[model samples]
Target chain A: MQDDANNPEKKVISDEEIKKIAQLSMLNLNQDELEMLKTDFGNTLKLFETLEKKDVDSVEVSYESSKISQPRRNDEVLHDNKTQKQQNADTSPYFNKKTGYFDVPPVIETE
Target chain B: MLHKLSLKQLHDGLKNKDFTSKELTGHYLDRIAKHDVNLNSFISVTSEHALAQAQEADKIIQRGEQTGMLTGIPIAQKDIFCTKGIKTTCCSKILAEFTPPYDATVIKKYQENNSIMIGKTNMDEFAMGGSNENSYFGLCANPWDLTRVPGGSSGGSASAVAARLCPGATGTDTGGSIRQPASFCGISGIKPTYGRISRYGMIAFASSLDQAGPMAPSAEDLAIMLQAMAGKDSQDMTSANIEVPNYLSYINESLKGKKVGLPKEFFQDGLDDKIRSKIEDAIEVLKQQGVEFVEISLPNSVLAVPTYYIIGPCEASSNLARYDGVRYGYRTNNPKNLESLYKDSRAEGFGDEVKRRILIGTYALSSGYYDAYYQKAQKIRKVIKEDFDKAFEKVDLILGPTTPSFAYKIGAMTKDPVKMYLGDIFTIPANLAGLPGMSIPVGFSNNMPIGMQLIGKAFAEPEMLNMAHIYQQNTDWHTQIPEKYTT
Candidate 1:
């Protein structure tokens, strides 16, 4: 790829993009983080500008592991140890005893 | 007497009855106790277990029993591996008190061979971050200079080896966790082809990219560890069925006509001049030894860090999801309900970088955005892999600097995650390609060490070892440890 200056189609990282990244990254950043990310993100995107000229089309992709699959293990019983109380206990601090399920604030905001 | 012997030297000494296994294990345990308080390379040192194993090894050797290549050697395992009765936190608060009930495949293999497990080393939480600074236990200092970082998530393993805390240690590489840290700390480490070592019980980072390998004092020693560590296992489906070659013997053979490629892209920009010069000088020495070098190109090489960000975090987010306040780990002190429990547990359990990557990964893999980012990056990942494959067809191995620069001061890139992520820039491509690669100390920039990486074809680890072994024979960088580390 050519440098960002040379690639006309490449968009300059903007505040909007930063917001999108923040949302994805689940970051609770202040204005300082957004501003700092502006430079950091730009540098990262700019480094990628080196990819524009190289033809990666002809290269063959590798499966990090070999393609051949292994046979499944026999259905043999292994050590199984757990009590009913252990399974049914209000195991999670997050678990609500009344509802018997996880509780979270609603993600959607009301108008 | 305690610090100078390499794994090979110590192994030979034990075999010859020059020293008992108890004596050797005691020596290492004593050194770790002495210097490790300042260096902080270990999370838990297994003194009691180590001595017991060492005594057993001595008995077996005296009984004329046969043992594997790693017999009687002391090795520190990265905290990511599950060690029964030992803390295996992956350096996160979530599993701080959790001891695994079973051993990881690699740990089991070591145990079977009677290799002494000296301790568990520290790492970046969930194997995130470039420097050991992300570790919740605290930052691990470079053995060479106390103020600087020993490049991380495998920082403890690298630091431990550099400081002679143990003969060698095992480290898992997701991106450049093993190689970059090994480079910065001036040690030898290899991230073998994925599946060369089983990942059955390793704390998952990026499952596709995660690999367990050895960090040692020399390429030849690394070979011995690799021989014991590499093989297929019924427990891990991803383990390869390829024949495990005798790596130590293979690396010592002639490399008269081997073709080496110097990728032009790795040397381009943002690289330290001193590191570049040292790598060039090393290449010159290799050329004199009759190893040929040719200029080559890996297009889309710059996309390494970006692709890694998407894939590694995406995998990490998924892998770490199991740590939800339920199964055998940290739970919030007080929570009104389950939602708060999950949120508070994670927020308190994970470090800043781990949280950041989890959020990033969760976002990328979430609905409505998977196509634009995750899928696109996977396609780009394929392109990157292909690029390496094509280059390997024409060259026996690819050589470059492990990181673009040397280890930076602690907190140098704390505010800049992107900059920290770039430390593994040159190293990540091999992970994406599923190829074997290694970092050997090339030379020092200022006082900190710089590393040169040797990348080989998929499953061509024997070739990579040969290249690193050949270079070490011609240079003294691998032999030079920090002055302060020696007693």
Candidate 2:
């Protein structure tokens, strides 16, 4: 197990680490929850104790259902390509005149 | 009339013109209306569309254009599958008003085979709970005894098939979802190897473990439905591209040379005496057919529940993040900001069980804890899989009681989620290993059905089905339904 210094004196989790985990989890924890997690983060680290014991070299990991691994799909575009703006602009749920974005109901409430 | 017929019998009747597809479909619809009000097995009954499809099937049959093996058979689909224009709520309030614009790959295959979709069945919200009580619509009562639970999260599918509401149903299993319910409800259900069926458009609970398979009255019926449901689809990149085996063709094969392994750990303490006796009886029957039983050890199975709790919920927490009340579904009434929107919408949309699992999962997969929980669970999961792999080298399949005990009365385990989760103890290892497993009726425990699970090596469902079929042929347990409930 790689033991890195966990900046114990720090009051809150570093923004970089928080951002990285948030992106992986797709969660938007508020400031309060994030603060709470700083103290609780050590508890989460307990899983490492279990993983560290495993002998990965002898694990013989097999993800394939069959012995033969088939080739992946060809990397050819079946249709005409669209501009980047054309792909990004449409945010409308019904229909978007801008950049082809599908705009659904707003996720947040306005004050 | 439809209620008494199995899928194979129904198909034969349709093919021989003994009964038209339209009449059979109507009969099933009428049965659903009469039974589902009390059983609470279905969330929505697509009677109009089902009848129309039956008419189309009749036309196809008349023209001698058979679409596939299961032409004109009525089957209920668990609500996790997104059926175009129908409410595809995973039995959660979050997706109460949500309707998908497309169909799950399994549903599409059923349509291609000319199967009549009876209705969408109820389930635990987001497939989170062991009991069907977690459903937003209400608990689906067991067909055998109204007060007891039909095990979940495919409880509705199992109950419907047991009560004969639909000849069969499609259910997704992440961790013991299909087999457990089949065990409780006294029917046959199979969870095929992970990636055997396409996950596209099926609201996923866990990416690595989630698999869709069939629940029905008999292993033969399950085999027939699995033929249509299994195989690769381009939409789901993870789908297995292996050749689809002819499942039905192997259903009646003899198991004389087969070796069935019984894991010693599974038969230890906590198993009910009645269930144990029933399993022993099943073994004797198998032995009479020249099938041998070998005792093996799965040292890691003791840790299966903990490993599953971490992995299933961790993946679930991630999978369910898609329901942010944004793209499509029920949104919070009023939210001051994005944070409140996400929190409140989820709080309101999800049931208590769903929230509890989400919290546990989030905690496990979080940064500081990832190694302790998720990584640890993954490593242990590997151990469980290795245990199975080593055992399979000496046996054609493994057999054990599907659950340590029979189904409990409603509200029995509702207060204790952990205890309720343990109901899946005997079954979850298969999902962890991505192997095909099934539950077939052996006998009764306290007059309720006792199911013996037959787990095969990955993609060995055909062999498992043959073994289960041999046992059923020698015993009358599969033929015995809850006598009083039929009235």
Candidate 3:
């Protein structure tokens, strides 16, 4: 097992890429945090780059819990406990009692 | 004396009228009150709730008909499990005020067995970091030395058990969250085979990799607690339908003629000499008990860390996308629109480590890079799993150091996230393979405890526990308490 864990070369994540990924992740990072992440992700990319050395062409993708051979249950509305459902909604901080939906800031904006 | 008692000892005391559950619970509560200010092990100490549960457990003992081993016993839970009507925060600000209407199957199991819930242990927020420094609650200290970390994200649970704040605690392991901390704290913890424990109501980290298990002062206590914890649940579709084995029946048995594989990859040049020597000493002890050690090779284990980081965060990024602030978690103040509600809420709520993983995950799973990063990592994961499968065919168990090194000072390795990622090389492979693994206190280096990891085949927790119990019977390492924690 060769330990090349600290090799920091061959892949440079650009600024536009960082902003795009953060947008996709739905996180708003400030300028300083984005700068730090660029460095961090650069190292992460390099760390993962070592995996390219392994000849994995013939290997299949194996999930961690592949051993759990469960039968697929019929997908239907299983919960009939409406009171329990309401209680669940009530546990949230922004649940609206009268509207019967979650409360959030208005989505559509118009002048 | 109460602090030193195992779970079995505590159960016996209650059954024989030697001590009331309230008194026992109070003993641990008093310890938490006195010591947790220094340890920062608990995010929220449920004293009133714990006392009430203790009263109920005491009543059940008085009835004395349907009581089980866990009845009248006090234990702590990692904040990740959702407790019905009680605040289950996962130690993240995102869900700091959020309560669930339904209890996690694991929590429901403990409640059903009449066990007392003492508190919610702190962790690396959302179970992200290798050290507890990433916790939103505060720095969770190793009881042995307050300045050093307890090797997280189960740092709080490990510290509580090792410091004797509680007789036992539950910890979830995605990538060595349980075993690494148990190693650092000089206690016993196990991550049972994946799917062996239900993950329902456990706030997701990496859904496929996460599994909950028990941590305690001794392997026998772990066996007892794990038995109560393990089972199939319909709520968790991934939870194994196989009947839970009687773990106790597997332990207290001889280890004569048992074959254990010492993976060559685990002892490569990178392992600290002091830690390596300690693992060798553990092997000598097992050898005396008629356990045969064979050197085996798992070639692809070298890539485990790199492979896991990609897969874990990719899953985490997808899983954490649920915290959009419109539903149950923290909502940002004065949101201008829905997009601001999602972005601003997450930005204000999640910690740095959590954000780091999410960013990496999103990038890996992105359109053009998916095949290069995420798919490549998954294929490598298969390579690592196959290595374990082959090793198991040659031997019944794989034994090695639980961590590459002993606990480092806080802030020492956090700056270099890659170095911190490499620290998990030994523990990551077991999680990658979904095999059952555990850490037992083997010896010490520089007054810090060393842990030897034992990885068993999938669904082979009984054999793993039997080996650990037999080793614990021969060694007093598990019984040694920190000098500071001793009254």
Candidate 4:
């Protein structure tokens, strides 16, 4: 396990890479924000690079509760359309709703 | 005077007719109205709802119905926990106008126990930052010194409790959100073992690490609150199916014959000299009480901060993907297309810290870098957990300082994200290992309170609470309130 903290080879995140990441994250960042993020991502990734130095070849990935297994529930509909409609009404103020459905841009274009 | 009373005292007072629940609730509401201006602890003060609940509690008490200690007690949620019809924002603009249709499991538990819902406290946006400065509302100042940040992301909860604005409040700890703020505010908070409390309605920051617990003036109050909040829930599959212990029963347990380990790694350089000495002095007090202390090692401790930051952000990236402008939450108006809508809404909604973490997370989990970053970090997380397990085999509990230093001035570490991440070095291991941990005020450094952390094995909260309660019995640090906030 080699410590990357002092390793001369640091992973430099480029502006193009940050742009790709923002696109994947569905976040719209302007030029100034992207510039700032490039520097921050580089610094943070350098810190994370040290993880490669640790001897974790045999360690298992930790996920979910250590002792508790995911409980299985009966496959049944708990809430009806009426209940869902009420919830939609509660959230209507935040989204554009028309005819009891959230109005969104067309997903497909006709040829 | 009512605000100063412990949960048990308040419950007894209610039962004895010394003060009605409405009166107690009003007293706290009045205090929040008057004092919360100086400390932006609350995001929404539910005055009307609180009064109505208090009135209902009075009727129950008047009828001599069997009730728990928390009944009729006024308390605040951390704003992360959803309450029916109350705006449950994670102190983030994305959910600023969003209201929950139902209560979180913990909130439901509190309601069932007949507790008054005082309000929702401010927090780090999406529980991301180390200081409350990341909140969309405003920075929640330390009650001790307004310029200093109340350590976050549970800063609002810690500040409200410290200022006596509420007798107790609910706080969620992912990384050191609960304990660090508890330490900074000179109060007590417990981050129960993962799955000890259900997280069905609590907004997810990091699903595997987030656990909601109580912040209050004393360990006894935390025990009472924990007793109510801890249990299995059908709604949360991750919640453990174990029986909830009566934490109150174990508060008086003697510390005699208990082996408390002092982790050597936690005492290394970077800890403030004054806080180190203060912890040492407190250890002396515990020593005099027949509790044995031994030097122990968590060899992989140094990697905790890096491991947590990677895993936390990665999970956050995935969890927060649901906040697209369509179903609920803040939606961008007049979008040309769905893609633009998502980009614009998130760009306009999330704060800088949230965006930073999301980017870091998105990058880590991206196609080429997933193996290098997220997977490797998860492996290191296992190593960190093993370190705790190995140490716990020889000791009943591990004790250390909660934070590396006293609370830093607001905006001091904001420029350096890594520096802010390091603030949680000592506290991250407990969350990493899914172990129960607590912070208790031990002494002061430069007029600011320092906290001594106690880390116990999984589900060993009763023993940990007993130790903290016994320690409090010998010290008055937890009893001391900031002079400025003391009415």
Candidate 5:
């Protein structure tokens, strides 16, 4: 919206691309939702077109703030206490008390 | 009568044996019970639990043990913080039935201080929207005008405090959540310097920018609440190991020689005329106290909203990928397989705005667009921070209108997400820079409260609070209550 040159490379995304994005996001969007997202993304992405005008070629990415992270703690294998484990076990349907392991449906499916 | 008492008065009352913690807690609970029907500010009102905690706090005071400013005080926690065995919905349907097995570090700190946990406040689900409308629990209203929204995602906390539902509440800011709502609802709130408070057990949305702080009636109360809430934690590595100063000690410090910058960019075209006039009046108050205001520029200020949306959604998409229906939170009733479970559960679990952010984030991080969107946004984020870095070189802190205008009507801005994102313009830059920022009640505009934001250099929270305290002393804005709720 600024200048034609400022908007030279507008990232145009397609509806098919929206479906793939929903899938990658693990969200099952219905057709209408997908259609809405196409327009939504188009409008939202236009905000970024403004970013291209700034000459930030030499600027480094800040994954976070300027503060340096605290030093890592040493790895220690401290087991959870019994009551705490029981409290956690109550949250899951598949916790195996006898085996001390949580069970899940087998990853391999035979059709 | 009790609800109107300042926090220090409540503490003194508890200490002098004038009223027990149970009585104080009961008074607040009763207020929330009666008044909250108009605001919907709470998701879970833990009345029984709160009273029980108040009883315990009474015992601690009875024993003559050590105590702090929050001892026996009742405080509301934003539902984003996981309270063990309490249904901690971040006002999302996905977590509507989800209760955590552990307390957030901020909650634990308050508990250690023997502060009573009144209830869990409502918020924009997963801290996604600029308004509380995005919540599954329903929209939270401004106490001043029930038809309008309390600017969110900390809307519930702000509204609750404004209506005297609770004395103080904890709110997390990713973009403008805490400050904006505080602005809208005519209360006070601060988002401490990044890592000033721990995030352990506080549900993440854009983990990089999310930091917790306090919302209260006044800046002095914020100093007390922040003292309890801040410090480093082993559970949150991003929490700064730096020492938290005695905020209250520094709160009463002089404002005579301190310099504050009024960014010309923030005061430019977008701001409402009334808000600008109020901020100028606030400037006069500060100037009378010998504080000087310099007109400065943050040239890239317009770019903050765009930069924050990209980074916020990207990290949110990744952080939120954890809710795949396996362990906790909502799961689809019957699923054919793991993939369907993940898809169906997430689709049904999240709201429209949340889904939009996840999709945008996913699309940006996917194979080809990562560099163009995510990486480019990160680079621009650095430029925004450097802009602040340059400004701080000349001024002690920055001052501006907390929102472009005061709170809009509930359904007014909900249809347009990009426009709603732009509304966060003034508050987003501070989150980007990892600086400490706060909003205090300045004056009223069109019968709605206006907030003035004070952003200090990183770790300059004491100065910010101190300066806010000075403004509050000179004006009665912070002490005013909504007329309809006054009775």
Candidate 6:
């Protein structure tokens, strides 16, 4: 048996690493949640580690394997302004909207 | 009584005036009210909307107009499909109250046929987990045993059908979501070739893997539903523009010279003894009908679960990036800053399983691990697909167990995510290969239903359904309903 495979603690992800991952994923987890995620991540990653042994050196990655591809249509307006306005209005409740535009936190800080 | 009828039977009944569409819809609504308390199969029961649609269907039938097979039959939509003016939560808190402003192409097709919409059924949150336990609403129990899961993330649709809540329902499969639940619930379902059904408004989980299909009591009923559901749409670029076959007409095709291949790896260790024996017996029944079985090898199929876990989560991480607090869905209240706003809203909206997959996916696609994890998994995915490609050269289709075992008790595999994933071993290869696969109730093992999977080449649903239909005609397993659910 491999030395690291037998040691359960060997793959334990650090708290800082988990925090960085959560940040990269745009998730804010509490300290308790972070600890739980670390253990869960460790277990799942161990399962994923089995892929390293597979021989895929000659295989090519496929994005879309389907042979049927539709020809692109000429660019034309499919929807009227009313439909666009309704769709815009639908998202008004989730964020700050002023004059049919979404309002967000300022990108730059000024004194 | 109306709930007991199949889609074909229901269509005939409506035409013969044996029952009105409104009465049929009312029967299912009453059952949903009476039994859904225990099953928790439905997220929202649209009685008023269903009655209104049924009344409209009755008018069409009265006018002596030619109508499709699903004209007035009641059906449920899996909550993942976007329904205009109806709440489609996907059983998650993030989109808990969000209503789509337009109908998904599948919903539009059913509505155009005037099929009564019973309700939106429950599912694993965002169709993530194999078991229904991951839903924000609550776990859905198997209608057969009540203590067991109905299998997910399409568990609610399967349970609702098994319990006679509706004639049929729509289900989406990424990795065995439809077929596993169909197997566990003793019903029938099919996951057509990837892009066979439009995914324009079906909420994305894994884009390349997800395909929507029908769930019903028998392959014939599924054919009836699939006739109405399959086709290309301009809204979804990935929807296949291939010829949609007349599945209903092909149901009675002879299986005399058809070839069915059994993957040697599928019958190996980890499969339950009883389920294996039942599948063997089912193969004998098909053999008597003159169907020939050839031994085939899918050597890389053993890697399906690992490959699926990597690719599924990675795509999910990128797809779910749209759920930030910017536009629609749940937003964190009073966020201090932009980063916290994105973080807190997602952290608060998503459940544990969803977060876990997001983390795994993000880590897989992270700077240092991309080539080792996500890219490598994709290459292995091609190998898995090739295994099926080579097998199809010698045989028309492949046969296997839908799941390795019968439905386990609710919460049994929740603690260990890997064990839950292992349950999908037999079903994941079809998704990886983007082939059409069906599951039909072959027999019972320990009083629980065992489903035998029939996988066909891309867009070969008619052939797959024909094989299953012939098997159903020779056996009575698909007609057997749970005693507790049957009145």
Candidate 1, residues A64-98, lDDT tens digits: the string is 43455566777885434344334434443445768
**Winner by lDDT between candidate 4 and candidate 1:** 4
- Report residue B401 deviation for candidate 4 (angstroms): 0.4
| Residue B227 alpha-carbon offset, candidate 2, angstroms | 0.7
Q: Candidate 1 on B327-439: residue-level lDDT in tens?
A: 55887776545556666677677777776677667766778867656766776788877778789889998999999887888888787676677678799999887889899
Docking class of 1: incorrect
lDDT of 4 by residue, B1-487 (tens): 8888899999999999899999999999999999999899999999999999999999999999998898899989999998888999899999998888778999999999999999999999999988898999989999999999999999999999999999999999999899999999999999999999999999999999999999999999999999989999988878998889889899898888899899889999888999999999999998998999999999888888888888999999999999888878888877778898899999989999999999999988888888888888888888888888888889999999999989889889887777788789999999988989899999997889999999999999999999999999999898888987678
lDDT of 6 by residue, B1-487 (tens): 6677778888999999899899999999988888999999999999999999999999999998998888888899999999988999999888997888778999999998889999999999999998899999998889899999999999999999999999999999999999999999999999999988999889999999999999999999999999899998888888888889899889898899989999999999889998899899989998998899999999999888878988999999999999887778888988777887799999999999899999999999999999999999889888888888999999999999999989999878876676787789999989988999999998897789999999999999999999899999999999888887787
Q: Report the number of the highest-DockQ candidate.
A: 3
What digit string (tens of lDDT, one per residue) describes model 5 on residues B21-57?
A: 9999998988888999879999989999999999999
> Cα lDDT for residue B94, model 6?
89
> Where does candidate 1 clash, by residue pair?
A1-A49, A1-A50, A1-A51, A1-A52, A1-A53, A25-B360, A94-B338, A103-B339
Q: State candidate 1's TM-score.
A: 0.88
Q: For candidate 5, write residues A24-98 as lDDT tens digits.
A: 999998988887767667778887778878888898776887566587767885546788768876766546768
The two-chain DockQ for each candidate, comma-separated, is 0.18, 0.11, 0.74, 0.55, 0.48, 0.55
Task: Arrange candidates, best DockQ first.
Answer: 3, 6, 4, 5, 1, 2
Model 3 stretches astray by more than 4 angstroms: A1-11, A72-78
- Writing each residue's lDDT as its tens digit, candidate 3 over A21-89 gives 999999989999998888888888878878878888887776554666777778786766788778888
TM-score on 0 to 1 scale for chain A of candidate 1: 0.58
Candidate 6 chain B, run of 10 with poorest lDDT: B413-422
The DockQ for candidate 3, computed on C-alphas, is: 0.74
Candidate 2 lDDT by residue in tens digits, B211-301:
9999987888888999999888888878888899998789788777888889999999889999999899888988889888889998788
Per-residue CA lDDT of model 3 for B297-324, tens digit only, reads: 9998888898889999999999999998
lDDT of 2 at B65: 72
TM values, all candidates: 0.88, 0.88, 0.97, 0.96, 0.96, 0.97
